[model samples]
Target: MRKIFLFMAAIISAFAISAQTQTIVIQGPNGKLMADLSVPSLNTNEKKTVAILMHGFGSNRHRPLLRAIYDKLSECGIGAIRFDFDGCGDSDGEFVDMTVPKEIADAKAVYEYVRDLPWVSDIYLIGHSQGGVVASMLAGELDKDAVKGVALLAPAAVLREDAIRGNTQGAKYDPITPPEYVELPSGIKIGRDYIVTAQTLPIYDAALQYQGPVLMLHGTSDIIVPYTYSLRYNDIYQNGSLRLIKGVDHSFNGYEKEAADIVANFFINTVNDYVL
Candidate 1:
């Protein structure tokens, strides 16, 4: 029987040693990325679609939103793999050394791993916050054929603007000549490499390359990365839709289930269409 998990931590704890889910590690650009793979039961000859779940800048795969999505996907007979970026969660590396490009590389590594899985017939990319930015660019790089669908939750294209303005999550610095690092109010220090690379990132340019279906969900009340970013994303993709949930914050604090259901359903429908 397949078990359904609720919270990120609880689900992870229950599946850590279960038969349906397994904890795996993938080597990323910076180091190891600890990941959890949850799949529904299937015949040996049957291949399944899987979604790669990416968390935000200061978050990990174990985030409640990501976990909720994982649960939904599993319940719908879709597989999901959520992992820590090189520097976050149980993965190896330092947070200060993390950057967008580095995270992209890490995502690429995960992509390579997932594509090679014998049981995975199709793949989708889903991300939140800066992770959404990574998913967009990565899909753009891989094109639509490689990634069947994409879902961006509060994509943070504003990172470039933040870099250009010499401010990141309230940490100020000189855009022209950034220091070794700047620490955010949350005490996570980002390196100069992060700011320099973010300033010139072709976020939308790369993301727009993927002509596949895309679903972007953002909250009007989000202050971290305005919902307008998602609107702009909706404007670029060859096929894309944006949903602005009123009153929901960036993290979807009280709307996790709603957001996750929308995302899971998008992927499920896309998979069904492709199979047909």
Candidate 2:
């Protein structure tokens, strides 16, 4: 009777350990950024690889698309961390102060935090839209050995072009004399610094510096960001591939599962290849 009770207790403990999620707060360039860290309940003692999920512009870390990817990665025995940018979601900061450079700094902070974990064997980045831009840049900036792979979904590299044209997010402003702040249709306020900084950023040049496996997914019907942008990335990356999803929007709305599976499989394969 005692042996049977002990066996049942051990099995329950193993089941509980298979999957776990935790709410964590990490310091960002501006302030605190809230995040959810999800780990698979694998019984192995080996160090695990983790993917950091980055949301699109004006979106929070808990956006449905991000959450869906996070769960899918966890189900695949991969861990994931999704966090809000400093000005968005539950993080501390004003949205008006947000910029591409600032968000890059925020991403670096999160990367450093995750990199120091003893249980993390490798790190990968999965970013959507603007977040994808940040991930690409950061992967380049970090030591080549630090980031094993990068996955971009409908990356919005058009911001740089829009800034140069003096029209960004449907608001026209003099590039040389932008206002201290401009409000968008959604009532989100962005500073002129954001425009000036984006205009001068060598996004592609910097992103292509990271020599790692890259996976880019874009939808043919994504009006916001043309699928050609991803094709351009594929051309730039030495070891990159692009997949065009048919008739889907920028958000991959109805094809969340497909997107998540692609990301998870890419990371899984990258990790396996690295190990071998």
Candidate 3:
């Protein structure tokens, strides 16, 4: 009878997990984009907090690592939403013509939309790679009251700086590329019509002054963005700290299970601290 009960519990748990996640498309200030929303199965019994996941540059909402993280967060009872930034994912926009400001504007729109969801109790932002910069900007200047915390995973210290130093190998996919040879991922093509050139300094600078609790994580083995960047960001922010994961890389690469655990744990703990 005990074994039978346990088997039934497992089947119920699987159903619950599947019901909590659904693919969605939303219209932001710029245009429509693809997003994946997930929630913990147990969360339906009670109100729960939410964390929004933003993927890295040259990536989309369906990246495996991010999907895994979202799944884990859902299992832990936190609601999650991951989307492709305008012009980047299933959203409508010209990727090369986009600037940092445009992306930030889109993120702001997402924040507003998510906050209005009937099931949300609180909202948090979690970003990876370039997405970290977007989250940081939103955390500081979001026009909404629902946003409660910020989390950066290998976020770029200075987006431009990271770009200048990024592997030219990856530049090829940039809908807009630097004067170097490299392929960008996610179909970001580089061309002369680039709309987000360095003049967008206003957006980048504004991020430094963000006002909110921040949590940064980076791995030492990350060749994409240095772990030192996360440390510096943590040092500068009044309400944050950087946790270095030894031997980890930019995408958390081979550390999927561990990375998901850490990201979910951070979401839980960060929200807990803010409420008190």
**Can you tell me which runs of candidate 1 are displaced by over 4 Å?**
1-19, 274-276
Question: Cα lDDT of model 2 overall?
Answer: 0.87
Give candidate 2's error at residue 260 in angstroms.
0.3
lDDT of 3 by residue, 175-200 (tens): 34454333356445643323235324
Clashes of 3: 18
Local accuracy by lDDT, each model = 0.89, 0.87, 0.71
User: How large is the C-alpha RMSD of every model relative to the true structure?
Assistant: 4.8, 5.4, 4.8
Question: How much does candidate 3 score in TM-score?
Answer: 0.80
Residue 218, model 3: Cα distance from true site in angstroms: 0.7
Which residue pairs collide in model 1, if any?
A: none
- In candidate 2, stretches whose alpha carbon ends up further than 4 angstroms from where it belongs are 1-17, 42-45, 274-276
Clashing pairs in 2: 18-41
Q: What are the per-residue Cα lDDT tens digits for candidate 2 across 84-185?
A: 998999999988889998999999999999998878888899999999999998988888788888999999998899888887778788888888987887
Worst 10-residue lDDT window for candidate 3 reads: 191-200
Per-prediction count of colliding residue pairs? Answer: 0, 1, 18
